[model samples]
Target: MQFVIDDVQKKNLTGKAVMNMSLGGSASQAVNRAIQALNNAGVVPVVAAGNENQDAGNTSPASAPNAITVGAIDARNDRKASFSNFGQSVDVFAPGVNILSVGITSNTATNTLSGTSMASPHVAGLAAYLMGLEGLNTVKAVTDRILALSDASGATVQQNTAGTTNRIANNGQL
Candidate 1:
C-alpha cells in the first residue's frame, strides 16, 4: 500500500488516485500500519469486507481505521449474498454476483466474478468519480462523499447485534 501511494505521490497523481485493495485477512500490526500510511499519504484504502459470512472486524484491512470495507449483494435480487461477510466493519454493500469486467488477458476480454472483491471495485470507482467531480483533495473527503451518497434503501445486509446498519452501494446516488 505504501509503495503504491509513494508511486502515485511521485507521479503527482495523488489527487487523482484512489487506492482500493480487495483482499485482507486476520488483523495485524503491519496491515494497520500500511493503512495508516496510505491515509497519511492522502490515499483512501478501500478493501473487501470478506466473503466468509463472518464478522469483517476480524479481517486486517477491514479492521483498519479509515479503511472503506465493502461487502457483497446479489444484483439479481438486490439482497445480501449469503456468503458475504458482515458486522460493524462493513462500510457498504455493492452488487457483486455476476458482475462483468475486464478479464486478465486483454482489454477486449471480459468475464464475471463474484464476492466482496467484486463489490469493492464498484464503490472504489464511484468514489473516484465523485472525487473528480467534487475536486476532493483528501482520502477523508472522497470517502465522505461516497458514504454520504450511499443508500439504505434496498439494503439486505444482516444487522449486527449492535443494531447498526451498513448501507448498500447506490450508483443512482451518483
Candidate 2:
C-alpha cells in the first residue's frame, strides 16, 4: 500500500488530505500508512470514526493516536447518528446530511449519503481552509486549532463508553 501511495503521490497531489473510504478490511494499517505519508508530505490526516455503532475504543484508525477521527451528527445536531462509532477516539462530530449539495459531480448537484464516512470531510475542509488563511503550516497546530474551536457540548453522546466520553471535555473548553 505504501508503494502504491508513493506512486500516486509522485504522480499527483501529494500534500492533500486523503480519506480511506473502503470498509470490511483491516483499515488501521492502511490508515497508519496514510498518516505516515501525510506526515512525510506535511499534510493533515482526517479519518472517519467508522459506522459500526460500537464504542470507538475498538475501531481502527479512528482508534489510532494522532489521527483526527470524526463522528457523524444529523441535521438536528442533537445526537450522534445511529451508525456513527463513538468512544474516546472520536475527536469531534460534524454534519453528515442525508443530502448534500456539491458542484463537483455537476454544476448543480445534490447527493444523498449517510455514515461517518460522509461526515469526516467537513472537518477536513475546515482544517484545510484554516490552514490556508492562518498559515498554520504544521499538522499539530492545525489539529489543535480545530479541537480548540469545536463545540464540546455534543461530546457526551450515550454511545460513547462511560469513562471514554468525558475525555473530550477534559481535552479543552468548548
Candidate 3:
C-alpha cells in the first residue's frame, strides 16, 4: 500500500500532507514508507495513536517515530479514555465524541464513539485550517503549531506504579 501511495505521491503536483489514519497490525512498514514519502515530498503524515488500552509502546504506526500520534479524549476532557493507549509516543489528544455523525442507527445524530482513530481526523482538519489561516508552507511548522495550540491543561501523564511497573519492568514476572 505504501509503495502504491508513494508512487502516486511522486506524481502529485499539488503537494499536500499525506495523512494515514489506519492503526494497529504490522503496518509499520507502510507508515515508514508514508513518512519517507511525506519527507521526500516535504509534507506531513499524521497518524492515530490507536484505541488499544495498552501502553503506547504496543500501538503500531502510532508508536512509529516522525508521524504525529493522536489520542482520544472524552467530553469533559479530564483523563485518557479507558480504551485510549497512553505513553510518551502519544503526540497529543483531541475531541473524539460525542460527535455528530452517521451512527449505527442509520440516523445522523449525536453518538459517542471513542478511539484515537476518531481523534486523528480532528487534528488533520485543524492542520488544514491552520495552513489556510496562517499561510503555512512547511509541514514541520504546521505540526509544531498544532502541538503548541493543543490544550495540555487536560492532558494526563501516566506514572509508573510499584507492582504494575515492577511486573512490566521485570519481564512480566510478579
Whole-model lDDT values for every prediction: 0.78, 0.64, 0.59
lDDT of 2 at 75: 50
| Residue pairs whose backbone atoms clash in candidate 3 | none
Candidate achieving the largest TM-score = 1
Q: How would you encode candidate 3's per-residue C-alpha lDDT over 59-156 as one tens digit per residue?
A: 56776667677766664643455676667767776655465545676665556566777777777777767777777757778767766555323334
Stretches off by above 4 angstroms in model 2 are: 1-24, 101-109, 151-174
* lDDT of candidate 1 over 32-145, digit per residue (tens): 889888888878788888888888888888878788888888877767788788778787788888888779898699998888899998888888888778789788887777
Off by over 4 Å in 1: 104-107, 151-164, 172-174
- What lDDT score goes with residue 80 in model 2? 70
- Candidate 2 residue 84 Cα shift, in angstroms, is 0.5
What's the distance in Å from true for residue 68, model 3? Answer: 0.9
Give the Cα RMSD of candidate 3: 8.9
Evaluate model 1: give its TM-score.
0.86
- Model 3 lDDT on a 0 to 1 scale: 0.59
What CA RMSD would candidate 1 show? 2.5
Measured by lDDT, the strongest candidate is 1
- Compared with the true structure, model 3 gives a TM-score of 0.71
Question: Which scores better on TM-score, 1 or 2?
Answer: 1
> Looking at model 2, which ten-residue stretch has the lowest summed lDDT?
164-173
